[model samples]
Each structure stands twice: as structure tokens, then as C-alpha cells.
Target: MIEIKDLHKSYKIGKNSLHVLKGINFSVEEGELVAIMGSSGSGKSTLLNILGMLDEADLGTYHLDGVEIKNLTEKTAANYRNKFLGFIFQSFNLINYKSALDNVALPLYYQNINRKERMERAMSYLEKVGLADWAKHLPNELSGGQKQRVAIARALAGQPKVILADELTGALDSTTSYEIMNLIQEINDEGKTILVVTHEDDIAHMTKRIVNLKDGVIIDDRKVKQVKALENV
Candidate 1:
């Protein structure tokens, strides 16, 4: 469902250029649950940004669901992002004043979905995330785990082809992190393609495969013995 080859990226810092990704190559098939693992400055974030179309590679190619992602106009990129990618960040990124329901409904609003359908879809996703009763609560009213659940629901509301979660459980306690990973596994069980960017070994083990990054390159990519999050929870 996704493919990349010889990807290279860099950023200019004052007079020096800092290379972030070098000759990166990989592919993710439909319905696969994978984790991209790396230490800080290992380029996992840069790779995730490129994969999410939030940034472009300075060299090489990227194909998402078969469409080459390069030189896209901002409008087109936004359209593709809405149509194909769902993002979950460590920071919930919910608007502080918006209720959980409205936050989940926000993407559908951008898609021009009508109010009735948007609310229905939003509520259904909230239900899936076990947060239906808290739908009307604002982010400040929820715990960290609850807020992240709301964020997950929001990501799923778009029905994107792929879900990209960056450090999704980084801010949570071990129990909550495992709970979130269980939700992710449940989503993957239903045949959703997911890519998680994380540095935690246990978090990466929850995925079916792990791609280890070091010094801006993929050092190891292999299938792993999947560790069900429920075991930890």
C-alpha cells in the first residue's frame, strides 16, 4: 500500500546542512501493522513526515496506494492527506475548547460531510474507542488516556487508508500505553494498515514488524513475534 526507494532528506542549519534520511527504502502492504523504531535524531520523524506527505524528500520516490507523492501542490497534498492518511500524535492536538465529539467530527467537516452524518460517524468512532459517554467532554475534562482515545477516534473518523501514529503512547503510563496498543491491535485485526513511529521496544513489539533506524538509515527491518498488548495490560 506504500512504497519508498532511495529516499534522502536534509535540512539547512545556518551554514551547515544536516542530513536526516539517507537512502531509505521500504514498503508496507495493505493490512500490515508495522513500527518504525529509532532513537532521537535517528530520522524516524523525518521518515514519518515524508510518508505522511507533511514533508517531501530531497531525493528518491514515494508511492502511496500507487500514486507517486512528489511535487504535489498544497491543495492536492491536503486533499490526498484527507483522503488517505490519518495521523495520531503524542500530543493529542485536540482543540482545547472543542468537545470530543466535535473534535472527531472536525475532519469530516473539512470533507464537507453534512452535520447529521458527521455526528453519527463521530459518535460511532467514539463508541469504538470506548469513549461514547464522554463525547461531550472537552479535552481538559479527560485524562491523558481518554484524550488519546479521543484522538484515536478522530483519526479513525476519516477512514483513511493508512494510520500514522507518532509516539502515540509516549506520554502515557505503561498500563495506558498498553491499553492504547490494544486498541491499535484491534484496529489492525480489522485489516487496517497502520504504521507506528516509536522508540520503545515493548511498543514496537506490539506491531507485527519492526523497522529500526540509525543515523538516518534503516539498519534493520524484519518481522517479529507479535506481542499482544493485552498480555501487558
Candidate 2:
């Protein structure tokens, strides 16, 4: 449900331009779980940002669900982001004062969903993530794994077409990382497309396909046997 062709991006330094992505091309079908793996400075984050519509590419084309993504007004981009993309960051990115339930409901609030339905949907997602009992807990009150689970719930609350997770398991211990990946796998099984950006080989193996990036270009891309996270957990 996502397509990109010869994508190019660059950033200007003091006097020199730093190229971040070069001639990138790939496609992700609906319901596929893919991992983008690269070392630091390999342009994985830049690719994810462009895919999420958080940044613009300097060249080439991107199509999400058949709509060409280029030159979108800020308002339109925000609308499309809310309607089509859900993001999970390594830092959690939760408001410190907001409880897990409210944090999950935040996106729905932006969608103008009413309080009752928002809470209902939020609680259901929290339940789906196995965090229903901790719904009222604030981020500070939860452990690292719990916090990521809350983040996952928040990501799913919108029911977006694709979920983009950036280093989702980076901060957790091995056990917790596997747990989070298990949840992500379950979500993909239900037909939501997902793209995870991670450097860890084990984490990459949890996905059905891996795209390896180096020096701002995709160096390798292939499908592999899916390693079920629950087995590791």
C-alpha cells in the first residue's frame, strides 16, 4: 500500500549539502511487516520520516494508498497523517502528565471524536495491548515495557493504514523487546501494514522482510522466514 521510486533527499550544512537518501526505491504491500535496518547515518530515519510525511523528499515520488504524496499543504499533510499513518518513537513521546488512557485518546481528540467514544476506543486499544488494567497509570508510573505497550496502544487507537515504529525496542531489555515485537506481530496478522526501523539483527528478523540501507541507499532487500517473537519471549 506504499510505493517510492528514486527518492532523493539532502540537507544543507554551513556551505556543503549532505545527501541523506539517494535513488531509493521500494514498495510495501498491504498487510506486510517490513523492517528497515541500517547503521547510524545510513538514512533509515530520513526514509521513515518521508514515509510518515513528517518530511519532504527533494526528488522522486511517493504514493500511499494510491495518493501521490508531494507538495501537500501542512493542513492536508496533517490530515493525511492522522488518517493514514500512526507513529511510535523510541522515546515513547507521551505527555508526562497525561495518563495512559488519555494519551491513547489524544489522537482521537484531534479527530474531533467525542469524549465517550474516544475513551471507549482508547480503552479497547489499551485492552488490546494488554494494558487495560494500567489505563489510569501515568508514564512515570509504568516500567519501560508498560510504557511501550501504552505507546503501541496509542498508535493503534487511530486505526491508521500503516504503523511506523522507530527503534521501538531500543530501550528495553531482551525479554521486553520480544514482548513488544510479539504485540507488533499480532497487529500485523490482523492486516495492518507495519514498517519498523531498527538496527538490531534479532529485531529485524522478527519482521517478514528486511531492507538494508547503507550510505543513503538500499543495499539489500529480501523476504525471510518470519521469526515469531513469542518464541523468543
Candidate 3:
């Protein structure tokens, strides 16, 4: 469902350019749960940003669900992002003042979905994440895990073709992380293509495939025996 060929990216630092991703290439099929692993500055997050169309690659190709992603007008990129990509961040990124349900409904607002329908869909996703009971609670009222769950529900409300999560479990305790991974596994089982960017070995092992990155290049790509997060939780 996603393809990248000879992807290269760099950033300008003063007069010199820092090359971040060097000739990265990979394809993620529909319904696959893949983890991209790397240490800091290994280009995994750079890769995720490129995949999410948050940043353009200096040179390379990124095709999402079929369309080539390069040189897109900001407006068009925003449109495609809403249409095809869902994101979960390490920080949860929930608005402090908004209730869980409203945060989940924010993306739909951008899509021009009406209020009633937006809340309806958002509530369904909140329920999917087992947060329907907490829908009216504000982010500050929820715990870290709960906030992340709300973020996941918000991502789901967009109904994106692929979900790109960066360090999704970084902030939570092991039990909470495993619980979140269990939720992710369940989502993947239901046919959503998912990619998680993480440095944690246990987190990576939870995915069906692991792609290792070092020094801005792919070092290893292999399918692993999936470890059930529930068992660990």
C-alpha cells in the first residue's frame, strides 16, 4: 500500500548539509504491522515525517496508497494527509482544553464534516479505544495512557489508510505500553496498515516485521514472530 525508492533527505545546517536518510527503500503492504527501529538521528523519524508528508525529502520518491508524494502544494498535501494518513505521537498531542471526544472530532472538523456526524464518528472511535466512558473528560483529567488512547481514537476518526506512530509507547509504563500495543495489534488485525517508529526492542518485537536503521540507512529488514502484547500486559 506504500512504496519508497531510493529515498534521500538532508537538512541545511549553516553552510553544510546534514544528510539524514540515505537511499532508504521499503514497501509496506496492506494490513501489515511494521516497526521502524533506530536510535536518535538514525533517520527513522525523518522517514516517518516523509511518509506522513509532514516534510518533503531532499531527493527520492514516496508513494502512498498509489499517488507519488513530492513537490505537493502545501494545501494539497494537507488535503491528502487528512484523506490518507493518521498519526499518533509520543506526546499524545491532545489539546489541553478540549474534551476527549472533541479532540477526536478535530480532524473531521478540518475535513468539513458537520458537527453531529463528526461527534458520532468520534464517539465510535473513542468506544473502539475503550474510552467512550471518558469521552467528556479533558486531557488533564486523564492519565498518560488514557490520553494516548484518546490520540489513537482521534487518529482513527480520520479513517486513514495508514497509521504512522512515532514513539507511541515511549512515555508510558511497561504495562500501559503493552496495553497500547495490544490495542495496536487488534487494529492491525482488523485490516489497517500500521507503521510504528520506535527504538525499544520490546516494542519493535510486538510488530510483525522489524526494519532496523543505522546511520541513515536500512540495516536489516525481517519478519519476526509476533509477540502478543496481551500476554505481557
Overall lDDT per candidate, in order of appearance: 0.96, 0.96, 0.95
Order of candidates by lDDT, top first? 1, 2, 3
lDDT of 1 by residue, 1-233 (tens): 99999999999999999999989999999999999999999999999999989899999999999999999999999999999999999998999999999999999998999999999999999999999999999999999999999999999999999999999999999999999999999999999999999989999999999999999999999999999998997
- Candidate 1: lDDT of 82? 97
Clashing pairs in model 2? none
lDDT of 1 at 118: 100
Task: Give lDDT for model 2.
Answer: 0.96
What range of 10 consecutive residues in model 2 has the weakest lDDT sum? Answer: 224-233
The alpha-carbon lDDT assigned to residue 209 of candidate 2 equals: 99
Q: Give per-model TM-scores.
A: 0.99, 0.98, 0.98
Residue range with the least summed lDDT across 10 consecutive positions in model 1: 45-54
